[model samples]
Target: MTAGPAEALHSWMPHSPCGAWCLPTGDALPKVSPARRALRLATLVAVVLTGPLCALTLSVLGPRGRAAVIRGWFRMVLGALGVRLRVYRPGALSLAPEERERPRDRGVLVVGNHSSWLDIVALNALQPVRMLAKAQVRHWPLIGALAARAGTFFVDRPRLSTLPATVAEVAGALRGGAAVGVFPEGTTWCGQATGRWKRAAFQAAIDAGVPARPVALRFVVDEQCTTAAGFLGEETLLTALLRTAALRGLVIEASVLPLVSPEGHDRRSMAAAAEAAVTEALGQPEAEHAVPEVAAAA
Candidate 1:
């Protein structure tokens, strides 16, 4: 059998450690003026210093209190960076009719397209969420400390032995009515295309018997995709941050799609449905799963 579209298209490129989406046209760095860069740097320093302190304060607070504090910080950060956000709730986009009608008692597993680190800030601006991040993030200086305080689940992907335990921890959080965020694609690609989403996070939703909500994230500036915001390739976190902060009139559009039920559902099928929703929302061609090279070669 021939490789599927996703496979045929994506097989050539290697996965990136930092989240990045690849575009067909290629990557072009965004230009930031000296004055704007200086201003943005100052603003970032203030936000970075304040984020951890707020995390410490919210640690002892109730869920409502913590969420309020987080949202306030997100707004401040976005304002300073000149990044506006447009959130489309159910029905406004291609979401299913029943999306808004679903029972939200149980915490939801939110999966999305990961293109830039800014995606995290944008989503948190929507609400406080516990993120499932890679283990490398756990070592990122002040950001790591703040992320830990915010209750991020860090997984060491290379150590497959720990996956079951990590899944259990994520499932426990979901069962407790805490919304969990994950980039199931494991690696970031340019937003122009998406990769195969891993099924582990979906399994956590299944274990908790909660629904998975697929959110589509896109960064736009001057009515075009802001690929410079992505963290892929050789770009460091600091570089991505600087580029994002220097952006003018940057708008983050987060379109929340329908929630897929985990009850009596298989992880693979659930992931596929979520992927399709996100692909359509982002205006990208849906990729068919590719056959493994070893299998295809046979």
Candidate 2:
């Protein structure tokens, strides 16, 4: 019997070459005490419980008011997780303050590297853009509820045939002057390595005639880069959350690079350009950036 698109998609799911080997284990990583971890977890739950109230409050606010509330909520989420966030605009550093703030109002396609669930929190904290999330994320506990309320675009990976429609939906949102976030790698990896970019999401930018903005995300602990926060391999989400909560002095650096125009570029070239921009911002040598051949096949 021939396999259906759903079955084929299950088999075609992207996988990273990064695993336990890419992460720091045992004494090599700095950790907070069990008591501290418990405190962080409790605080996180408290903050999440306020999501419904926040959503209700947001419905009555104007655009500026809504953005303010969303930013505060996401910042509180990062604080609850005991993670520090630092946002940098490498491309706009030389520009005047007013010039640097201009892009915030534009509808651009935001693309970036994915390493942990924190990536979502950190990016949304920077600005309340609609993110492209896997369909399963829409069913997660409190997190899923918050994502749905925040206008996240959920992609059904199993329904591979629906991709064009998904892209069209995203394009329509972009055309309406909303920034859409996507991780074209389509899978999470340890911060030490990354996967190849998939071109499907980039098509939305081309279709909407919007620029693609590449952002680089890095997780640092105790002044050194670490993959302790990564949700990789067979690790459960609970395990990853606990691990992140226990880490001391963890900082997530998000660098916003210059935008890549979709004009005169096809989806493949546009995706490659965005990937190259992110890779450069990450400061990794070309050889150090890992692209699993298996992921490309997927």
Candidate 3:
């Protein structure tokens, strides 16, 4: 018998018990040492106090200079959190002849898995991007002001009526040669399993007719999956921040997966394809969220 859409995809989407909220069932996380905690606290304080000054300087630089500033800030923030970032394109050392000649100027829509707030810093460390953030982030303490100054787009998710405008803004940004980063999951999930990719962000890629780049983020501590990095459940921002700051040997590995062209597909299909790409890159079984047509095509 042939498998149904969900079942066929489920065969590939294995759950990682250690991905989210490492607890009784999954591998437990290590306790943070007092000395390390104090060190991290000092680092955070320094970054927080100096970040705005850096942003102010960034405002005066040209586009290339601004990108440099963003990358530098990302590196600084990751260092403060004690999370090392490793970024590499898959099979980059062995590119095909045809791919070698492929155009590198494609305006990108970066769609990635969302687990921790640290994802933003880790990803930006690899490449500077205009991030689409929730409206509440505009009010976040020091980072909020810096993010706005650096041109982060804010969205009001609860209001369905505002989506068209947001999509248009994202498309405009892409058309003007700006790369945008969006978390397609719409909400945080324990790193164990990625949730469905919301179709809203994909619409921007569709409208701009650009490649939707899939990025997969994996957070590890001592070479093991760490739940201490996830910002899920009832965890408040402060709680999550404190937990991440206290973590030692945290490493974020970001894999830039294959790009999904939006030429022939609608928003839902594009989202499903991007989701599958990210899941596969993360070593999870291939899965499509609520897009049966995509599964059928596969």
Best by lDDT: 2
Indicate the worst ten consecutive residues by lDDT in candidate 1: 289-298
Deviation of model 1 at 54, angstroms = 0.7
Please write out the lDDT profile of model 2 over residues 71-113, one tens digit for every residue.
8888987888778886666646465664444354467888999
| Clashing residue pairs, backbone N/CA/C < 3 A, model 2 | none
For every model shown, what is its TM-score relative to the native structure? 0.82, 0.88, 0.82
In candidate 3, position 216 carries an lDDT of 85
**Global CA lDDT of candidate 1, please?**
0.73
Instruction: For residues 190-290, write the lDDT of model 3, one tens digit per residue.
Output: 77766777788788988888878788888877777655678765557777887777666777877776678888899988999988878877774222221
Per candidate, the number of residue pairs that clash is 7, 0, 2
**2 against 3, candidate with superior lDDT:** 2
- Model 2 backbone overlap count: 0
Query: Model-by-model lDDT, in order?
Result: 0.73, 0.79, 0.72
Query: What ranges in model 2 sit over 4 Å off?
Result: 1-12, 95-105, 284-298
Model 1 lDDT tens row, 182-237: 98877666676567888888999998998988888887767777566677765577
